[model samples]
Structure formats: C-alpha cells, structure tokens
Target: MSQIPLLDLKAQFETMREEIYEAIRQVVESQYFVLGPVVRKFEESLEQYVGASHAVGCASGTDALILALAALDIGPGDEVVTTPFSFFSTASCAYKVGARPRFVDIDPGSFNMDPEKLAEAIGPRTRAILPVHLFGQCAAMQPILQTAAAHDIPVVEDAAQALGSTYEAPDGGGSGHAGTLGRLGCYSFFPSKNLGGFGDGGAVVTDDEQLAERLRSLRVHGGVQMYHHEDVGWNSRLDALQAAVLAVKLPRLDLWGQGRAENAKRYDALFAESGLVEAGAVRLPRRTGTGRHIFNQYTLRAKDRDRLRAHLNEAGVGHSVYYPVALHQQECFQELGYGEGSFPEAERACAEVLSLPVYPELTPAMLEQVVETIGRFY
Candidate 1:
C-alpha cells in the first residue's frame, strides 16, 4: 500500500512552482514587507470577492475575531454566544477580550450552532452571536440574524473554515456568499485553509464603512496617524509576503473547493454502500441545503474513533481528529463553571469524530483506498 499522508501541500506547491516563485520574487524585489502595496492589493481583491465594502488584513484568525469583537466594544461582563465544536481559537478570541464565551450545542447534521439553541442562550448580558461556519459549511444565518436583530446584538461570523460557502436569503433576491452576511466577518488564510497563504494571515470584512474604518485602525495598533492612538488595539497586521502568496492562491480557491466537494460526494457514496451506514458503524458529512460542502476534513462519526483511527493509520492512510476535546471540557475554561455534562453533543463529537485525508489534490484511487481501509476496519 502507498504511504498516503494527509494534506500534501508540497504536491500543490510543485504544481504551481513558477507562479509561486515569481510571486515570492516580486515581493522580495519590493522591500516593503509590512502593509505594502501587495498587501493592500490583496485586501482590495478579497473585499471585492466577498462583496464587502472594506477588508482589514490582520496577523491571524484569532486576532481577527478578537479585533472584530473588540471593535464592537464587547468586553468585561459581556457574553458572546458560540458553539463548542470548533477550533479552540473561536472561543479563545472571545476570552481574549475578557468577554465570556457562552456555549450552545451544535446542530448534529450541520455541525454548526443550532439557531434554536442560540436563541435559548441569549440573555440581557449577551452582546453578540459568534456563529462559526464550521468544517466548510455556513451556519444557519437567517435565523441567527433575526435573533440577534431582535436583541439588537451584532453577528460576528467566524468564517475561518468557510470562504466559498454561501446562503439563500428568504426574499430570494439577496442570496449571497459567506463572510458578508454578518456585521463583521473574520477569515483565516492559514496554510491549511482553502484560501491559504505562505504563513499566518487573516482579515476582517464588513459592508459598513464605519466598522471597516475601525477595523483598519485597529489593525494598525489603533492609530490613524503616526503619533496618535484613537483607542487600545493589538498590533495585528498582515505582512506582504503572506499577502503575495495568497494573491496567487485566491484565484484557484473556487476550483479547489469544487474538487473537495466532488471528493466528499464520492466518500458519501462509497461509505453508504460499504455496509457501514446500514450497520450503523459510521455516518457521513453533511451537504448543506443551500450551498456547497468543501470537505475541509471529511470528518465522520465512528464508534471508538480513536481505535478506528489507529486501524486506518496502520493501513498507511493518514487521518486526524479535528478536535478531540470540547471547549467546556478543556481545563482552560473550567472557570466558566461548565462540568462534564454541560454540552453532551459536543463532548460526544469530540470522542467520536475522526477526520480523514480530504484535500482537493486527493485522487479517486487515494479516496478509494481511504474508504476501503475504513471498510476493512469495520
């Protein structure tokens, strides 16, 4: 059997060798590393792609979320509702600003924040609803928006895992993409994401001009001028080198995302017929009702996920558990007073969910091997 490792980024780099080299060389030729013309151009192009009036480049995804919440003045004694099933950074960002992260169980199928649960979690101290578009699909947005609007709280989208994901509005006219539906949308360009860069990079996108302006100022350490600081803000800025790499990669995101979606479809079909579905040993990834599923990780819920993971790895198929520990169960958030049974679904998912190799570059033969290996285990 071939030693098929997960996420062969070197394969992608090899395919785009000349273009990447040229982009890097161009950035090197121009000595402006911090917030240079390339960075500005990337920001403008990203804003245009998302239909946002502004895009403020930041240092990382966590910082992007923190800055967005901080810009909204949600701090100390305030609460932000979010799910516990995402990357630790989602809740960590809220905590960074001294705001408590209120947990809500995720929708089992979508793996996103359940709107009904979100509505139940809101209270007088709830400042915003930080809905994460987890694992490449957008969360249920219209209902979340309605709930937030009723309480006059903003929606800060954690779009780190979803750049191409879209939604259909109720009226049928404003059917648009993710990262633009909320008051402020935060995106990550970490090397593993669909829209990735050479290194850590992130952005805050917004249609509101004032919010956009505040984000811009915040990215630059709260300074509109050289010697003046309008407010306290972190030193978060997207460097030019990562921007240049992302500028080269952005055009290919849609194509790569489509490839991932196709691979996911193949996995769904293979798994269904493999007797796993009938035997109730495993379940498949969710294809969102309105938009696409990019198969960021091709996660499946399996019985004894850790043991199953060991079986697959022994068969030379690489895999991962996106998050084996839920936030409330982690030691960091014990102060929130959430004990063992606080969020059962999230805890269950943590122990049962397993991520298989699902990059766009994966061939059908490789996918077949993955499914076949899992079948052998079951």
Candidate 2:
C-alpha cells in the first residue's frame, strides 16, 4: 500500500497538462504580465461564473479581504465582527486596515459563525459583518445578512474555500453562490483551492458597481489612472499568468466540486459503518443548509485527536488540522482581552478537529485505506 496524501495536485494537473501549457505559453508570448486583456477576460469569466455583477482580481486572498475593507472605508476606530475559528487572514485583515476584529464563536456542526451570537458582538463601532464560508460550507447568511441590514452595515464573505458552493435562503427565497450572497465576496486562487491557479491569486465580487470600481482602483495603489491617486491602497494586482491558469480551471470547478462531494459521501458511509460515530470515538462533518458542501477538507472531531494524528502519520496516511489555535487565544491578540475559555466552541474545535484526504482525484481504494487506518487506530 502507498501513502494516501491529503491532496494530489499532480493528478489534477495531469488531466489538463497541455491545456495549462498552452495558456501559459500564450501569456509568455504576449509579454503582458500585469493586469491586461488576459486578466480582464478571466475576471469577466469569473464574474459570470460566480453570478456577480463585478469581479476584481487581486494578488492574494488576504489582500482581497483588505481591499474589500478599504473600499468600504473601514479604518481605525471601526470594528469588523467575524468568526474566531477561521484562517488568520479572516481576522487579521481587519487588523491590517486599522480596524478591530470582534470575535464570535462558531457553530460546532458547520464550523461557521453562529448567527445567534452575532447580535451580542456588534457594537457601535461595528463597521462590517465578515463571515467565513469555512471548509466550503456557507455560513448562516440569511440571519447574518438580516442583522447586518438592521445595523446598516455591509456583509463581506470570506469565500476563500467555497468558490462554487451555494446557499439557499431559509425563507424559501432562492439560492445564491457563496461569494455572491454577501455585499462583497472574497475568493482565493491559492494552489489548494477548488479553483486554484498555479500561484497565489484572489478576487473580490460584488453587485455594487461603485464598490467594484473602487476595488479595481484599490488594487493598483489607489489610482485608476496612470499617476493620479485617489486613496491610499496597496499594490495587490493579480498576475496575468495566474489569471490565465485560473481561467483554464474555472470551467471545470463545479465538476471537481462534485467529485469532492462524492468522496466525502464515501468517507461518511465508511466512518459510520466502522462504528466510530456510534461509540462516540469520532464525529463526522455535518451538512446543515440545502446548499452544496464542496468538502474542501473533510474534517471530523475525534477523541484523543493528537494520538489519532500520530497513528495516521505512522500508517503513512496524510492528515492535518486546519487550525490548532483559536484566533482570540493567539499571543498577538492578547490585548483584545480574550482569555482562555472565552469561546468554548471554537477552542474545543481547535483541540479536536482533524481533516482527512477528500480531494477529487482520490480513488475508492485510497478512501478505504484511509478509513481502515482510522478504524485500526480506534
């Protein structure tokens, strides 16, 4: 038996190697490295794919968040309410723009911000409601949007891991793609993402034409023209090469997402049959809303998580913890005054969550091997 890696980018690349080579060659021949026709074409394609009126490409996912915040004029003395269990960039982006991040605990089932606790966290300084679509599952956006509307604050979605995922409104309204559901939706083209490019890339999508125009300017040092400056912004323009690669992959993103979902189903059934759930030894990821879960990483809560991780490592199985520490507990956030036990749910998640291989290219035999390894460990 060979090692079952957590993700297999090589397998994905082999399927479209020539297509990718051709795209890269086109960029090299044109010699247009910065934002130009190639980047614009990709951006337009992304806008149509994500169902957003506008999509602005940037340098990285973290920069996407910062640009969005800057476009909203959220600066010092303002606060952005967000979940504490997500990637560092989700909270750190607020700090980058000189705004404070107000932490909210996550729903243990979905690993997303609990909308029930959102109201209590919003203060007069609250400028934006930033919710992360963690592990490709949409946050409870209906309530989050309603709360934001009540306060006249904008909702910026961190859809870094959920490019094609959708969320159906609970009120029987309709479904919208993850990034397009909020006022400004941020996406990542990091190599590991579902719609990943060859290198770092990101974009911000919005229906607000004004914000979209501002985002375009913000990515190029706050100047739409060659030298005229309007506002202070970062140099965060997305590379033409990355955009070209991403454009090649965008059309197949939903198909890849489907494959990931199928893999997740297999894991769910295998874990259930192994009696781990019944014995309370492990808890599988849960699907909450009527939307699709792309399963960026199939994470589960396990008893004695560290030992289980070690066992998998010894067995030559790949596994990882999305986050090992809650944001509030990080040393850099000490002045925020969040002590231990402040967010019990997020802290518990940080301690027990472990992600397994759920990439699209995994074979059923490989999935079985992963489950067998876990079953033996238990």
Identify the leading candidate in terms of TM-score: 2
> What tens-digit string does per-residue lDDT give for candidate 2 at 1-378?
799999999999999999999999999999999999999999999999989999999999999999999999999999999999989999999999999899999999999999999999999999999999999999999989999999899999999999999999888877899999889999999999989988899999999999999999999989999789998878999999999899899999999999999999999999999998899989999998559889888999999999999999999999999999999988998889999999999999999999999999999999999989999998
The residue-level lDDT of candidate 1 at 95 comes to 88
Residue 148 in candidate 2, Cα distance off native in Å:
0.8
Model 1: per-residue Cα lDDT over 220-269, one tens digit each: 87886766899887789999999988888888888888888888888888
Off by over 4 Å in 1: 170-173
TM-score of each: 0.98, 0.99
Judged by whole-model lDDT over C-alpha atoms, candidate 1 comes out at 0.87
What lDDT is reached at residue 366 by model 2?
A: 97
Instruction: Pick out the ten consecutive residues of candidate 1 with the lowest summed lDDT.
Output: 168-177
In angstroms, the error of model 1 at 334 is 0.6
Q: After superposition, how far is residue 278 of candidate 2 from its true place, in Å?
A: 0.7
Q: Which residue pairs come into collision in candidate 1? A: none
- Assess candidate 1 and give its TM-score to the true structure: 0.98
